[model samples]
Target: MDETTTAGPAPATTVGPAPVGPAPAGTAPVGPAPAGTAVAAESGGWLELLADDCSPGDIQRLRAALLAGADDATRRRVESEAQLAETIRARLADRGRDARELRVRDDLVRRLASLRDSAGLLQEVVAQSRFLLGVDVAYIMLPTADGGRLRIDIVDGSLGDTLQGVVLRDGEGLGGEVMRSGRPLWSESYLDDGRLRRVRSVDSIAVSEHLGGILGVPLRFGRSTLGVLLAADRRPRRFSDHEVELLAGLAAHAAVALRNAQLFEENQRAVADLRQSNEALKRTDELRRRAGELREQLTAEVLRGGGIPEVGRAVARAVGLPVQVLGADGARLDAGPGTDDIDVVAVTGSAPERWLSGQEPASRTAIGRDHLAVVPIRMRDGCAGCLVAVSDVRIGDETVRLLEIGAMTAALVVATERSVAEAELRTRGAFVTALLAGDGDDAELRRRAVAADIDIDAIGVVVVLDNAGQDERAVAAAATRIAAELHGWVAQHADRFVVLARQHDVASVRARIAALGDGDLPAAGGIAPAAGGVAAVRTAHEAARQTAAVLLALKLPGAVATAAEVGPYRSLFSHAGRDDIAAFVEAALGPVLAYDRARGRDLATTLEAFLGQSQHHARTCEQLCIHPNTLYQRLERIGELLGTGWREPGRTLQLQLALHLRGLAQTLAPDVGRRGNTP
Candidate 1:
């Protein structure tokens, strides 16, 4: 180092060979020595190897040369070149791999973005996975509700149709194993694979579809495995680890999409159900509100003292339907204008018998396309009537309930009205009784009668009803009808109904009484003469009672004996001292009366007829409808019964008066002659 360091610069040019040197006798000649030549040759080979295309083996050879004998410069050059080549190759490979991965990710993103809904999302996921994974078929198998099986949901690829809608139990197929384990699974040859339990149906489908290699990855959301995403190939081949990884990645994306779709569908169904429930509630509330309104209207009408017609109209307006009120006898009570054609009888008749029984109200749709709702108008005693409503369309349950409420209200109103009417009638009856009894002065009676709505100025008759063995209620009801017909007033008197009517109404009152017929013991009635003022009313009442008593005694059952019709008999009977009258009748007509009684003959009748004809034989015969000889013989018999001189003027006058008196006695008290006494 010391000697070299002191030297100046060495020549850069190469020296040419000089003179040939001779070799020593025993020593080898040192002409261009082989060791230096060999070193130069190795260095050149390394340089060429590094400069040209070379393999790992060539680079290794170059490295060996450097380690063996190459200079520092050659070694450094070879090391640098080798590192550069290695780096270039590695970078190129990485770039290519990255590009392929980027394409797959971009395709997946594009497909996911294209989906507008869950169904489309599922289909695209399966299709994209199938295409990217390069499998024969791809499908998604979602777990069933029970979590014991998987149903093929979306399928794609060449043989996708063959596997569509296939189902597999939890441990049945490759896909089922993946779902059960919540992990990925693969089978190169599924038919021969024993690791996964085989199902004949699933295997048959696989066989039919010519599927061999299969790879399944669990589709997971949160901690739960929702299903399996599967890829299958037609030919038997082992699935590369990279391929399985790629499929699992696709399956992960698919799981998220499928879960989102399921949630979306569930949300949509829930929203629809909620909407329907809201509508139903709204309708129910509306019906309740309407029914409440109707009930209020009906109650208001009833409280206002509305009658049947007014109530019917109010109900019709409230419910928008036609209404009918029927009496207990099934008669139409509301006979207002325009109601005659309503066929109320038909409505009532069509009502269910149970309603009439006063149990619960009922409603039905009638044959005439009308909805009929009927409710029994029940009172404390019984069902007094029924309220019916008819509508063009069927009503709701709420509306029917309202109708029932209205019926109850109407019934209460009717009962109240009846009670008021009865009270008024009682008051009127008491007034009439006091007046007939002559309990007050004429002026006081007249004033009281006016206040009672009795027409003192009008000529009125008194009618005495004999309601023997008949229901007092029926008699009272009948009297009411008579009063209505005669436009008069009726009052209860003892066990009879006494009616007061004007002279013109007397005949009508009598006719009405006749129409009522005899009740129980052959009902008898008597009419007093029409007269004005309260005094006359008292007299007429007495006269009517006497007449009724007379008719009853005479065995004239169901007879209406009037004062004017009975004539002189009423006048004579009114002079009662009935005992004296009976004595006089016995004295004058005793012999004839005795003869008639003993033989049950017409001796008394013949004597009266002979006197009635004024002693003319032919007229007497014609009056008695007998032959002259028969009349003569009957007259001789009467003379014998009456004793001699009975046909003389003085005797005939006494005998005629006695005959009239006898008839009067018979009418006044039919049992008088039998008892030989007066009543």
Candidate 2:
């Protein structure tokens, strides 16, 4: 029998001999070899095979079989199971590592992706953090403005029901201690830890049975600590190194997210502020444009054919008011924006003092109980009149401001119109006066006089005076006083206008006033005979204006002029070319002016009085309230400097003109030191 042939019972022919067996498909065949040689050669393969399943102990058994002449099919079958087992073990190890990595990566990715909704970013960060570490409770607490409190922004699970939106104060509890130090804390047991304190003061701090192994890491951005991230276990659980690292990463991400959100909010606020400012600027521009248009329209209307009364009526209608146009005194009723058909509307009486006196920013009277607005009709010169309106509702501030501005424009138009009308009246009156004086036809003269409101039979007269720089109160008072005095004189004579003073042309007023009543009226008090009629008025006005101008030019360390006076330079008034007048002023006043420059004295006072007194010692002394001796001494000095006798006729006239010019300069001057240096 061939040993190579497979048999039920094999016969041992040698100490180590080959045995026969059927081979499995796709396996190498095994054969007999020398005992030691075969064992040695096959032991390496068997050891490598045993590494798949049974390990080194199985290698011994395979080596023994090889020495006992094991067949090729048996060894090959053994090798297959060992190799198959080894491949399966390697695959299983790789799968486990991949699964662990996938879980960690998926968690990180999900947490990062959840930051889209800013409202819930903190909540998601806390809730998802449970998977990566040993944490029974996780919360994000943001620092509040007040140092004592920390605002719980988000918490995990049912923690919201127990601790949602909680505030913890510093040094009050475990969380408090963490915030106070601005550092991470770790404790095996929160209640048991000696460094941790239990909060008892507030009823809101929820007391759990035992929160162990608590950890609090500060959430910070640069030097600014935003809040803290807290994690705790119910049963004490130590955190691994990797878990701590994960928490730090979470804290970093949280800080960045919060900062980014804040920056975004600030950007939005800046945009809103810019838009608001732009809108305000646009509204202001529109208001300015509207004001310009309104001014243009009102000016055009006044320049057109409308008289003051007509313009007043139109303005009153536009602004919804009852309008009155008064003369400069506010007493002389000039016109009313009222229709005669409207019987219920009463016109302003000749005297307006009763209605408009003692009022500030003008006056207001309620129409029934609902509405009122009173605005002074202010002119560039002064307030000539006022516009008063009443409505059935309360007026707002903006509306009042607008009404005032509109009223001011209307007042300016009225003033301009008045000036034009007055000038026309004056020209017409002068023409009529010349005709009557020239032996014109009696009927024509009387007819023209009546039409022009002139009194040819009473003798023509004009009285002009300084208007006090358009000081409305002073002008009105002076005008009233002057009118009363003239009326007294006229009443004694007849119902003749002894002094008919209009508000225009002060230059000729004194002459006109002087021509009245066959020179029978008493003398004007303290006014020189040379300065009668329109000349007197012109002289007084020129004196005042000049005094104001002088004070302004000299910077004469003083307050405003309360009073000013001018007297005639008789000889200069009689004769002297225009060029001679300028030269005379330069020579006479030049020495005094030089003295003033050097000494800073108000020499203007003495110079003005000396010229007005015609260089007479008694007159100069009386006017200056000094003794004649003192007046003479001053004059002697002046004459010595001027190189002439103080009483010389030609010199007197030159000195007077110089004094008048100096006074004129003062009139144009600004009133300095009016407001004392109080501030």
lDDT of 2 at 645: 70
Worst 10 residues of 2 by lDDT: 488-497
| Clash number by candidate, in order | 0, 34
Reference-based TM-score of each model: 0.41, 0.37
Model 1, total clashes: 0
Positional deviation of residue 644's Cα in model 2 after best superposition, in angstroms: 83
lDDT (C-alpha, whole model) for all candidates = 0.68, 0.51
lDDT tens digits, residues 253-345, model 1?
A: 777777777777788889999998998789779867876776677677777767777766666666666667776646566654444556643
Q: Write candidate 2's Cα lDDT for 209-324 as tens digits.
A: 24567677777789887788888777776665545656767777777776766666677789999999898788678656655665565667667855556555655555454544
Score candidate 1 by TM-score against the native.
0.41
Per-residue error for 659 in candidate 2, Å, reads: 57
Q: Which candidate is the best by TM-score?
A: 1
